[model samples]
Target chain A: MELLVFLIFAFLAVAAALVVVAHKNPVYSTMALVFTLFSVAVLFILLGAPFIGVLQVLIYTGAIVVLFLFVIMLLNIGREDSQIAGHKAQLFFALLGAVSFGSLVILALSSLRPKVLAPLTPELVSLKALASTLFNEFLLPFEIIGLLLTVAVIGATVAARRPTAEESAATAAERSIETKEARP
Target chain B: MNVDVVVTVAKIAVVLGLLLQVAPIMVWVERRGSAMMQDRPGPNRLGPFGLFQALADAVKFLFKEDVTPAAADKPLYLMAPALALLPAFTTSVVIPWGPNFTWDGKEYAFTVSNADTGVLLFLALASLGVYSLVMAGYASNNKFSLLGSIRASAQLISYELAMTVAVLAVIIPVGSFHLTDVVAYQRTNTWNCLLQPFGFLVFCIAAFAETNRLPFDLPEAESELVAGFHTEYSAMRFAAFFQAEYTSMAALSALGCTLFLGGWSLPWLNYEGMGWLGVALGLGTLLAKVGVCMFVFVWVRWTFPRFRYDQLMRLGWKFLLPVALLNLIAVSAMTLAGWL
Candidate 1:
C-alpha cells in the first residue's frame, strides 16, 4: 500500500512538473507547478518525516506558489507571455531535464539498499533536532547560510534600486526635453 | 510477550494496521470542537451526543453518487483525494504513543514506525500531499476551483519554511532528530514549550497554516474560493479531504505534544514507573497533552481573523522565518553555555 501510494504521488509530481514547463497558459503552468510541489511533499511524508512533510506543504505550497501567483497577477503576464518562449528551445530543455532527472532516478533506484550510513535513532526530527544538527554538526554550513541570507538581502536592494533609478532618470530627461521644446 | 511476536504483530497492525482508524476519530473531535466553539449544535441530532455523526456522515458519503463532470480529467480526478489523504494517514507511523512494555517477561517498545529519519520522511510526504489539491483543482477545470487550489498551494508552501525552521529550533538543543530522544530530553526537566517558547509559538502558528485551519484557511475560504480546490468534489472524495485535514491536525498535535509537552511524561511522576499503572499513566498523559493542543487548534481557529493572502505570505517569509532562525541561534548559544 505504501509503495503504491508513493509511486502514484511520484508519477503525479514528475508528470505535473513536466506539464508545468510544457503548458501554453502561464496560469495553467503555475497551477501545474503547485501540483508538482505538493506531490513531492507527499513523498516526503511517506518517508516518515511528517515534520518535513508539513514544512514542504507550508513552505512550497503555501508561500512559494503564492509568490508565483502574486507575480503572475501583478505582471498580468497572460497567455501571450507564456507562449513567447520558443517551443524548440523548450523541447530541448525538456529533453535535457528528462535525461538528467531520469539518470538521477536510475542511480537512486540502483542503490535502493545502500549501506545505512548513520545509525537509526528513534527521534521525532522536530525543531530541536534540526537546531542541534545545524548548529553542532553542520555549524559551518549554518554560518554560511547566514552569510547567504545577508548577500541575498543586499543583492535584492541593489537590484531593485538600479532598475527604478534608471527608469526614473529616463522619465525625467524626457520631461525636460518636452519643457525645452515648449519654451523655444 | 516475546520480542519476535511483538515485532511481527506491531509491524503489521501498528505500522500500517488498525491504528490507522484513529485518524477518523480525529475528524469527529474537530467537528464537535468547531461546532461547540461557534455556539451551535453541529451533528448531535444524528446520534447520541453526535458521537456517531462521523459514521453516519461516512455512510452518506459512501452511498452518494460519484459525480465525474464532463470536463474533468477522470483518472487524475479520481486519484486526487487518495493522493491528498495517503500522506496524511502515513505521517503518524513514527509517533511514539507510549514507552516500551515488558509484558510477561519480554520487552516490546511502543511505537508505530521507528525510522531514524522519520521527521524528514514526514516532511516529504506532506509536501507531496499538496499535489492532490492542485490536481483536483486543475482537473476540475473550473475557475473557482483552480483559483482556490492555487491559493491553497501557495499558502501551504509559504508557511512550511517557518514550520521547518521552528522544528529546527527545537532540534538544535537536543542534538538528535529522534522523537524518542526529544521526548526523553523533555522528560528529564522542562517541556520544550517552557524552554523554547519562541519556537513553540512559531510551530503552533505554522501548524495552523500547514493544516490550512481558519486564520490561515485561505484555501477553503468559502467566502472566496467556493469550497476552494475541492469545490466540485462530492461524496467520499470531499470527505477524504476533510479527513486528511483533521488527521493532519491530529498528527501535528501528537508531534507537538511529544516535542514540547514531553511526550507521555507527567510532571508528578518520575521515569521509573514500569507496570500497567505506568502504561496507563503514560498513555493518559499523552492523550491529555494532545487533547489540549487540539483544543488550542480549535480555539485559535475561532479567535483570530483569517490573514489576507499577502499578509499571510509576508508573515511567514518576513517575520516567522527570521524569528525562527534567530531563536535557533539563541538556543544554540544557550545550550553551549549550559543554561538549558
Candidate 2:
C-alpha cells in the first residue's frame, strides 16, 4: 500500500514538475510547482520522515513558493514569449544539467550497500528519535545550515534596504562633481 | 479494515462533521456579539435570537447566481474557493479535541490522524490557505481583486513567521511536536499562557493577522479593496471565503487553546484513566475554551479600529517578529536550564 501511494505521488510530482517547466503563464507554473512540492512532501512521509515531509510543505511550498507567487503577482508577469533563437542554448544547458544530476543519483545509489537501512516502524521513527539523531549526530551540519540561512536573511535585508538621507546626499554630491569635471 | 482503521475513519467523520458546523455557529456569534457591542439589534428576524439566520444566509448563498466574470480565468476562478476551504477542513484533524479513552480492553486515541509531525502539519496546511486568496484575486481579472489578494498574501506571509516562531516556543518546552504532548505538558504544570506570556501574546496577535481579523484586515477593508480577493466572487464562491475564514478562526482558536491555554484541561482536575467520563468532560472543556476564544475574536473585531496598511505591515514585521524571536530564545534558554 505504501509503495502504491508512493508511486502515484511520484508520478504526480513528475507531471506537475513538467507542468512547472512547460506552462506559459507564470501563475499557472507556480501553482503547478505547488503540486510538485506537495507530491514530494507525500513522498517524504512515505520514507518514514513525516517531520521532514511537513517541513517540506511548511518551508518550501508555504514560504518559498508564496514568495515566488508574490514576486510574480507584484511584477504582473504575463505569458512568456517564446524565443526560438534561445531554444538551442536552453536545451543544451537543460540536457547537460539533467545528465549530470542523473549520473550523480546513479553513482550514489550504486555506492550505497543494498538494504543498508532497517525497515521503518512507528516506534523506530518517533519524534524523540528524530530529534536525538538531529541534535547528537547531525548537530554541526544543522546549526551551520541555520547560520547560513540567517546570513542570507541579513544579506537580503541589507541588499533591499533603501538609502538614508545622508547617503543619498553624498551620492548627489558625487554626481554633481562628476558633471563639473565633465563640463570643465 | 482492522478496528483501528475503522476507529480512525469514524473519528475523521465526527471531527469533519463538527468542523462543518463552525461557520453557522461562528456567524451567529459574530453577528450577535457585534450587535451587543454596538448597542444595536442583530439578525433576530430569521429565528429566535437570530439562531436560524445562518440557515437563511446559507440558502441565499446557495440559491444566488454563481457568477463568473466576463474576463476572468474560468478554471482558476472556480477552483479558488475549494482551495480556500480544503485546508480549513483538513487542519482540524491535528487538533486533539478530546481525551483518549479505554473501552473493552482497547485504547482509542481521540484525534483522527495522530501523525508524528502533529502540529507542524497544521502549519503546513494552514500556510497553503494563502493560495486560495492569491488565485481568487489573480483569476478575478479585476484590479481590486488582484490588489486584495496581493495585500492578503503579503500580510499572511509576514505574520506567519511570527506565528511559527511563537509556536516553536510551545514546542520547545514540550520536546515534541504533537498537540497531545503540549496538553500533557500543561496538565503536568501550568498552562503556557502563565509560563510563556510573551509567546501567548505574540501567538494571539499573529492569529488575528493570520485570520485577517480587524486591525490587520487591510486586505479586505471595504473602502480599499471592495471585499478584497473575493470581490469578483458571488453566491457560493463568496460564501466559500466567509466559511473558510470562520473555520480557520475556529482552527486557530483550537490551536491556541491547546498550545497556550492547556486545551480541554482543567487546572483543578485530571481526566486520565476515567474512561468515557474523561472523554465527555474533556471534549466539553475544549469546546468551552474554543467558544471563549471565539468570543474574544468577535469582541476584538468590534472594539478595535482597523490598522492602516503600512502600520499593519510594520507591526507584523517590525514588532511581532522580534518579540516572537525573543520569546523563542527565552523559552529555549529556560528549557536548557531545566527551568520549564
Candidate 3:
C-alpha cells in the first residue's frame, strides 16, 4: 500500500513539474509548480520525514513560489511576454537545462543503495523521535538555520531595494532644475 | 483491510464534511460580528437571526454565473478558483481536531491526516493557497487583477517567513513539530500563549496577514484595487475565492488552537491520567480552544481598519520578522543557559 501511494505521489510530482516547464503562461507554470511542491510534500511523508515534507510545502510552495509570482505580477510581464521563448539561443539553453537536470537526477537515482529502510511504524516515527533528533544531536545545525534565515531576509531586502524608474526620473528632474538655477 | 485504514478514511470524510459546513458559518459569523461591532444589525432578515445565512450564501454562490473575460486565457481562468480552493480544503487535514481513544477494544486517533509533522503539514497546505490568487490574477489579463495578485503574493510571502519562524519558536521549547504533541505540551504546562507570548503574537499577526485579512488585506482593497485578483472573476468562480479565504481563516484558527491553546485539551484538567475522564476532558478542551480562536479572528477583523499596502509590507518585514528572529535567539540562549 505504501509503495502504491509512493508511486502515485511520485507520478504526480513529476507530471506537475513537467507542466511547470511546458506551459506557455507564466501564471499557469507557477500554479503547476505549486502542485509539484505539494506532491513532493506527500512523498516526504511517505519517506518518514513528515516534518521536512510539510516544511517543503509551507516554505517553498507558500513562500518562495509566492515571491516568484509576486515578482512576475509586479513587473507586469503579461501573457504575451510570458509565452515560450522564441529565440533559437533560448531554446538551446532550455534543452541544455533539461538535459543537465535529467542527468543529475539519473545519477542520484543510480547511486541509491539497494538496502531497504526499516518499515515506518507509527510509534517509531512519532513527533517525539523527530524532536529528539532535531534538538539533541542536530543542535548546531538548528542554531545555524536561525542565522541563515537572518541572512536570507537581509538578501531579499537588498534585492527588492533597487530604485524604480520613477525615483530615478524625479532625481534627474531635480538635478536638471538645480543646474539651470546655478548657471543663471 | 485493517482498522487503521478504515479509521483514516473515515477521518478524511469527517474533515471534508466539517470544512463544508464550517466555512459558510464562518462567513455568517464574520458578517454578524462585524455588524455588531460597528453598531448595526447583521443578517437578521435571513433565518433565525441569520443562522441560515450561510445556506442562503451557498445557494446564491452556486447559482451565480461562472464568468470569463473575453480576452482572458479561458482554460487557466477557469482553473484558478479550483486551484485556490483545493489547497485550502487540504489544509484542514493536519489539524488534530479531537483526541485519540480506545473504544470497543480498538485504538483510534482523531485527526484528518496523522503525519508526524502535524503543524508543519498545516503550514505547507496553507502556503499553497497563494497559487489560486496568483493564477486567477494572471489569467484574467486585467490590470486590477494583476495588481491584486502582486499584493497578495508579496504580502503572503513576507508574512510567511515571520509565521514560520514564530512556529519554530513554539516548536523548539515543546521539542516537537506534531500538532498533537504541541497540544500535549500546552496541556501539561500553561498554554503556549502564556509560555511563549512573543511567539504567540507573531503567529497571530502573521496568520491574519497570511490569510489576507484586514488590516493586512491589501490584495483586494476595493477602495483602490477594485476587488484585486478576483476583479475579473464572477459568479461561482468568485465564490470559490470567497470560500477559500474563510476556509483558510478557519484552518489558521485550528492551527492556533493546536500550537498555543492546546489541541483537544480542556483548561484546568489534571495532567496525570484519570481514566476515561481525562480523554473526554482533552477532547472538550481542544474544541473550546479552537472555538475561542475562531471568535477572536472575527473580532479582530471587525476591530481594525485595513492597512496601507506599503505599511502592511513594512510591518511584516520591519517589525514581525525582527521580533521572530529575536525570539528564536532568546529561546536558544535560554536553552543554552538551562533556563527553559
DockQ of 1: 0.19
The number of the candidate with the highest TM-score is 2
lDDT of 1 by residue, B1-340 (tens): 5567667565457445433555566667767877888888877876678788778778899999978889887776888898888877777767777776776687655666665555655665565566677678767868788777777767777677777778877777777667877887887768999999999989888889988888988878888888888888998899888878877777778888887888888776764466767766776778778778877877887778888989988898888889998998999899899888
DockQ of every candidate: 0.19, 0.80, 0.65
Candidate 2 residue lDDT tens string, A64-181: 9999999899988876543244678888998999999999999999988866687778877887787788999999999999999999989999999999999999999999999999
State the C-alpha RMSD over the true interface residues for candidate 2, after superposing those residues.
0.9
Per-model fnat list? 0.17, 0.83, 1.00
| DockQ winner | 2
**Root-mean-square deviation of candidate 2:** 2.1
Task: After the best TM-score superposition of candidate 1, give how far the Cα of residue B98 lies from its true spot, in angstroms.
Answer: 1.0
Query: Comparing 1 and 2 by DockQ, which wins?
Result: 2
Model with the higher lDDT, candidate 1 or 2: 2
Q: Write the per-residue lDDT of candidate 1 for residues A92-136, one digit (tens) a residue.
A: 998999999999999999989957576535454555676679799
Chain A: TM-score in each model: 0.68, 0.82, 0.65
Model 3, global lDDT: 0.80
Each model's TM-score?
A: 0.74, 0.95, 0.83
Best lDDT goes to which candidate?
2
